[model samples]
Target: VITGARYPRLRRSGWICFGSWLAIAIWLAIVSPDGSSTKDARVKNCHVGGPEKYQRYVLGALLPEVDQFMLGFRLITSVDPLFTGEQASSLSNLTKTIYTDLESDPDFHALGSVMPGAYDELWARKFDHGHYFLYVPPGLDHKSPAPALVFLHGSGGNFKAYTWLLSRVADECGMVLISPSYGMGNWDSQGGVRAVEAALDDAGKDIPIDMNRIHLAGLSNGGLGVSRVAASDQGKRFRSLTFLSGVCDAAAIATDAFKKQWSGKPVLIITGTDDDRVPLNHVSSYASSMRDSGAGVEMSTYDGADHFLFFSHRDRCLEELSRWFTRQLAPALPSSKELKGQ
Candidate 1:
């Protein structure tokens, strides 16, 4: 009887030891120094497991707050772990790249920390009604009011990343960047219009915004909002419109009232050929309708790119947008001769 009990206890202990060693070995293989497994690959592969597990081990191991935030974001956005579509894959890969860099790179992490605080100051001091992210490029002040580019975020909650990425346009083109946050990013109603107008009003109070130079832009579902807002009574406030990886409502834009409101205004659209979410053909057709409706519409298409081309092909998109903005501003700017005369 004593020998039998000892044998069972020994067997249990042996199995526990084996299991521990096996787990350690698997961990070592995944995090080996030989470069077989990389952090980027781990971040990109969502099917391995949920972001919770991945965040705990790989993504935000250094910053617990960031880890928690990412987990919350995943939940809010309803990111499917098993989603293998091109748009999902691209968005996942880009998001992972950004967070992983934030975790590993000190400079990026520091910028990420400082940006939110600045936005908080704006929200606390000036805007108290609605949520928004603002970025005023260097050298812009009350003495010389800068042009404003108001962007509407797509579904998946309004991320600071959108504002951060768009800051390049603000910096390059000397424009103020303001992105208004709508709940769940549904901006196709009266509330959406109010949110945008309220943000503009709040921002205008502190920052000198050139009302005539304001441009409205949107992405994905935001494109729908853009169409609705642009056709509202306040639609005349915007000087131009831009659609990225999105399209305007066909029925709305095809109306006589919309055409009358948007006539002579320049519109820029950039899209990808392989975007499964927003098909290229649909975008082209929308552009035709906009053009027919008297809006000066220009469309640029990228080859083999997907819905997340705004992120995947960031440089090209920004550069093109910057040039387009400059072109629009050129006509409004006083000629060299006029300046000399002044």
Candidate 2:
């Protein structure tokens, strides 16, 4: 019986295995160094710039995958010249500058070249329930009933990260910038809405704010969150809303109450056509839907821009936002009697 053996011979190619191992080694060399993970390398090479760079590096190191996906880079490659202790001190000093020093500094232009605003002062405080960051424009005081902009930070960002940009906006628009943190680096958790309410109220106590001109603003996750909040009964408190790189879920606002509450209220949605995180088509469709729902909707787009469009188009955004807020809220200048009453 010349029947072949039931077992078949197996073939293994050392060359193929060696090639695979070589490719893996190359990838590791490119993405990592000295046996450390890419994340560790990024942290070791972290660089802190102004608020934007601080937000990028710190958030990248802490939330690598999410930050990379949104910001479009791991923000790490070459080694950082800063030592561990130096980096720690640098981060601390930056935090103090953004969150503590600027707040307490009586000089109006405390940020100097970092942000524009002559005589504009920044302040931050942690209340019993939430954290509040306020930017008071030049000449603003208990008597100046300035328009208030309640800013919400995106995921992996805090009031400190946005203080430079939003404070500048507040200065340009002649408004008070009020940024509140929900204790954590998030705005979609329980008590989130209440926390915002509390922060705004607390800020009102410190400075005269035009309740009728109060507006909600945010970018990315903050944008979506403000949209959701503005559609609720709680949103009636604000005069209008501005969303950057954010989209409102049509399904969530399908109800008539949401539409009715937002009806006649203006909403400005700014997005980039090339945003992968929040696709352009999605933002367009949401704006259309909101318009149909009787909300005064305005959409602005930056061509060939992605999720981080704000970094490049910030000046344009500020201009558009100021115009939109002025047009929708119509916050007239308070007279001497009004200021005194306030």
The TM-score, computed over Cα atoms with residue i paired to residue i, of candidate 1 is 0.68
Task: For residues 271-304, write the lDDT of model 2, one tens digit per residue.
Answer: 9887777899888888888888888888888887
User: All candidates' TM-scores?
Assistant: 0.68, 0.60
Cα lDDT computed for each candidate against the true fold: 0.69, 0.59
TM-score between candidate 2 and the true structure: 0.60
Best by lDDT: 1
Residue-wise C-alpha lDDT for candidate 1, range 75-168, written one tens digit per residue: 6345554334544545666777756744463322322221222233334432112656566775666577789998988865455566667777
Candidate topping TM-score = 1
Q: Scored by Cα lDDT, where does model 1 land?
A: 0.69
**Model 1: per-residue Cα lDDT at residue 174:** 89
